[model samples]
Target: MTIPLVTVTGKSVDDKVTVERTGFEEILPKLDGNPDTSSDDSVNPLERGTELRVTVQSEVYQAWGSVFEQRIGTDVDYDPSTERVSFTLDGPPTRGPPITRAAFSPRGTGTHIGKFAGTTCYRPTGGSSCTAADVYLKSANDGFANCFTIEGDLVVERLPDSGSLYGSPGCGGAVIEGQSFFGERLSRSSAYEIKGDVTFEGYTNIRDRVELLEAGGGVHFKDDVRIDGKVKKMRGVTVDGSLYFDQGSSSNELKIGDGTVIKGDLVAHGRIKVSDTVEVHGEIYTTNRKITESGGGDGLVDETGNSKPSSEIHKSHPLSQVRGEMRRDLTHMITSDRPGRVDMSAKEPATGDPAPDLTGATLDCDADGTAETCRLGAGTYKLDHLILGHGDELELDTSGGSIKIYVEGGVEVPKNAHIQVLGNNPNQVEVYVEGQGAGSDTFHMYSGSGAGGKVTTPQDKASKFWVYMDPSDEVRLKQDTSFTGVIYGPGNAPDGDGVDIYLDKQSTVKGAVVGNFEKFTNLATVKYDATLQNKYALAAGGAARGQVAYLRTSARVVSVDS
Candidate 1:
């Protein structure tokens, strides 16, 4: 059906020229002092004139009047063939501001794992997380190499600190590490340093390599477990899972425990000792290549394959490190290069520019989302003690760019305080403290009471908020409350009995932390956001350990990164 167009008319022809507009079509105006004919096709509305004017269906459509006023660009040349639709906004659009603070990757290539640098302890109780830097958790207080008291199941992975929970394609299947700095001669294991002997209270799921340089105390599986990794320099290994031995080395004795299963071939140096059922999927390759086995339960139940030892045992294997130097072997195996541990130093947080008074002006920093809101857009703000005590909701408008807040004195956030950031990256919002010492100079964020203070964003984009304050006070990152940024409260012990950075059992920190981490009243998880390593130049303003090197090569290795 050919629908006829209805043109709304006005008496004042000069002020309002009528244009015919069908259902969602562009307006075809009568440019000249004549009405457009009914059969007239769409034509350019511009008449030869210096100024431009647009005619609508009626003078009552005043919206186009304001649209033309805010139109950007030089010329109004008409393109008759093309029709374009646009989404218009009355207010200004949001854009990240030109960053003022210096921006640089703290770790030049992010090869260091100093993300969780704790003087006392860097304890990960239950959950696991990725780290961009090498974690130096050797507690100075405790004698051992950071006593890892694993009760349930404590995990530590060497994944990228990509400010995300899932894996990334940047590293693929390869473990993220600086091999040049941590070569086999340099590093034994990848990103962990646990003292004492080896014991898998849970299931043993390992690949690559898990070195046990010293078995003076002997290895033990306190519970039912599975073993898969390549263990070295142990006196004897009793397998609960499968076993693969390099029979090509020396006459290595084999001690198979109860219910032992072998995925590959089992090659023992001396006579095989079995207490229970021994099952080998492949043939046994030993020194003499002859079948010689003894013991209780069931000897070589999978004797289905040829029971004799195969003769592939003397093809010149790298038996140097395996059997030792003919004299000092298992007893002389140094646990780990403990004496050669890389001397570590933490990145102290920026104390920010000092404040003259103990407490300054309180902000109208309350957001009710209706009449009033705290608009903390992009830009650097130097205030004295920002206390978010009033109103349940406080919103920081980060629509412009990164918001760097340098607070003097301290900051107190009470319970149920909902601080919403309008930005994405947690690095985009920073609050650096300029505390004096103890007392009012502490950073106090009271959360985890009922429903704690949640400093989240519209998307709650992983880890998205940060605060660098006095280490002597309480920055509670607890239950029902979620903050998504790095917390650097390094140096200075917590005063009398106060905790440095207290996190409750149900609390989980998205980013990393640097302080005297001791008190965790409950199970807590701190997944180090690797993206924060050099996410932005450690630009906390003042009193910060500005971009310290893990191990500087030359004195003139100054990275002129912006």
Candidate 2:
């Protein structure tokens, strides 16, 4: 595709140049490269002045240069020492990449004069987008004002002592086509709206209103955050630290991770899962589903069902609210009325057929490796059965890409076996087991007398790991084995094929384990990471539109008398 270019020429020494668009070649040398080559190819390169200073009026800019005989500008000064010379003009500022967008870093704390076309990221120092310590958006005519909408992501990272994002009074708002991130803390009086997923990595003090219009990826806060204004229609949010939501505000499917605290009143349309030792300073209000507290003696608390303030929590059976919700969600995935078909009258074997012979099975590691140690590379492998004995080391390497291990029978990772994941990201590995027809799939992990080896992913990529089994399967994690990932099985099937998850004594799950029925015994913990909902949603081809539609189904309006 041909890119239309704009040229800025100085009539005299006192005149200045203004760029109304994003795609413009560099007219003057700002660094080591010659600027004269960027001028009109028909004009003589030597005709342009040798030492010239060109001031840009846009927040984003891109310049292309060609070969020239002599030197262009001898001395050029551009702020932000980490700026690069070569940049691509993606498209017009209103449009994204593959068009006329300019790829130049804005320097100084002054007003920028250009617009951007594609997703723009500003890091401290990188080739991607803007990464300045402090960014100032001046008058509507300056900075990113000319661009009505950013066709891509808009990320802003702050320096250690940097302040909040500064915008002029005339700045209406910003529309980002992709995700938006603010690395630093914002003041209590700050107000803004984001169309994509928003993340706040630092301590954010929220006093004013902040709206996330289309949070398809969900909102994440890594540190402490307090919301004083009303947050309406937010879905799938995770707070690593303490979260304060004002009274009477509503959200959907909120998960509070481990070691976090929640303050103020919270109303959710979906499930509200809390982890061990989490302290809720205020009451929880659920409009549709119930609240499940992991590791705590109080089991599932249904805010809509029994109104005795609380009910006898049962760990063996699924929460009444959860059963209904799961059935609905599973129905969306499976169409048949008998979604999970398994005969309840048929007698099933307690254990799977003795591990099938490994004669034709694909081997991931060398045959010479002893039961104590083994190594596996990333790829797709089909196995009849997978057995990891005690003290055995199974290293799964997925640095190249994601690894999928499909087992046709059962999987047994006995106690004390070391399962180390080489990749730091959890999304790098997936294990699927297609058990022997109905009610035969089994994942057994017996407890050892002492501490067993852990099956965990790196702390940062904790949510990437996944394990999928048949609808009617038995998954048991016993005695000191820690797992950090998602375990997805079938929902309730009264006629038979219901999944059962048993977390016995000292077992801890950092992510989620979804099944038809779950039982926790002797200090077992299930810390729900709410971000996984969004991750799983995206993985299932669900759009990350931020808000939950079900919560907004019934709307009401009331007039207040002044």
Candidate 3:
């Protein structure tokens, strides 16, 4: 329930300490009640040796999303000059978590620290979790707990006799919206125009303003979903619709290891096994016969059966449809027998010249190159097997224009091999890897780049370097390296297996990604650049099926904490 907002690393002197975090908005200055004292626009610092207990709580930063948790430490100070916060503490240890960073405010003075009776116990579920807020009325305790977080989706097993989550979720009459209660659905009272299935480049306060619009329900969400870089609650908002991330873009996530986050609806093909740690952001739409509970039951509890609910858990769908028997709506296949999900037949190697092998040659396309540097200029180059292995330096000069390379065989960029894009425009280079067989068509983006050949583009311009893989083999973003580009792959034929991209635990991707299959051993944080989508869809003269996206909503006004 507590996040070491930012750990307090160490203490310098007894009265002064150091923190490992930054970005303090002037520790909430003590709420002085004096009137008309505008002359001194300065905080009245705590008197010397005044052992102050500082609760460095998170303040609002719409840009950073939301600070959903809290951490505590003692003794705080803010320097206006450096604009940083310092701390004084009861030196180390006897502790839970290290003190986090914060602006100066008397500990426990904020409304967030209010003492209210709570049950952490949930009911029929279905309630929106708000920020550290003291709601307008009695308390906030629907399946969505009070100020505290509930970890995953809250589903109503049995709506209280009131037939609503504590009478429209205790936020008083305000529209529970913004990055805090994003994708959440409530019963009545004031409602935010929250649009489900948001294909967002960014989210606005007005949730309905996005490209997609639909109310969500009747789906089962599983696992912890973390939006990389978007400051959010531990338990993310349940999508009334679906966590259809980016129909166009994929996710670079902190879904951790085996930590899959399914936001909105879930319709599995067979019996759904609910794990102990598995969290649902929405209701599970399956017959009691179709679902089973494993592990200690915190995820799904049945009040009626005292074990698993006999009735199906749904958001809005009718029970008769899901409870009696598993119908077609509840059982379906994701990979239906279909041919060619993507349109890749349009762009083929222009029939012009026989493929040239750039195995050991340092062929410079324009200027005279040294023995080690191979320069490629702005032109359509067709190659059979391109292996710029160890000691090969290939320079793609896009200053003249865009460079398109069509390969008929496998391409390998091994250790010590480097490919540099000598251009600023993001959409300047294209490399399509397509060969006769699967192994021959493999695009080895990473082949023992033992800590080398880290290719990057100016974040927003990540689309500048495009790699097309017809039947993608594998693209691994090695550890300690950052990548910025679109990894396009597969699906031009009915028998194709779609796209395949592998990501390393420590690797970070900055652009878009579309693959039929993705593997993550650890957390892969992707800071997506939305601009790449347009250029991707237009690649190969607008015949490209689509690109990927890591939807990042820019900072906008979600609400004003009163």
Instruction: Report lDDT per candidate.
Output: 0.37, 0.41, 0.36
TM-scores for all predictions: 0.42, 0.34, 0.36
RMSD of 2: 27.5
Best by TM-score: 1
TM-score of 2: 0.34
lDDT string, candidate 1, 224-312, tens digits: 22222233323223334333343333454444554445544454333345544556654454443334445555555554544423342
* Backbone Cα, N, C clashes tallied per candidate: 16, 26, 22
| Candidate 3: regions farther than 4 A off | 1-346, 350-371, 437-441, 447-449, 458-460, 477-482, 492-496, 538-562
TM-score of 1: 0.42
* Model 2: ten consecutive residues of lowest lDDT: 91-100
Task: Report the Cα lDDT for candidate 1.
Answer: 0.37
| Candidate closer to the true structure by TM-score (higher is better), 1 or 3 | 1
Off by over 4 Å in 2: 1-359, 362-370, 425-427, 437-441, 492-497, 537-562
lDDT of 2 by residue, 1-562 (tens): 1223344443443245443333334443232232233444322222221221233333342232221101231223333443423322111111011101111111112212222111222221124443211111111112232222333323332111222222122332223343233333233344344333444445444333454333334445555554434443333444455454332333433445433333333433344566444444434445434566666433322233222243322222333432332211111211122223222222122222221222355333322335556655655556656666666666766665555666767766666665677766433566666666424338766657746546766652435566666656777777777776666554343233345666666666655554432444445554444344235311311111111111101112322221
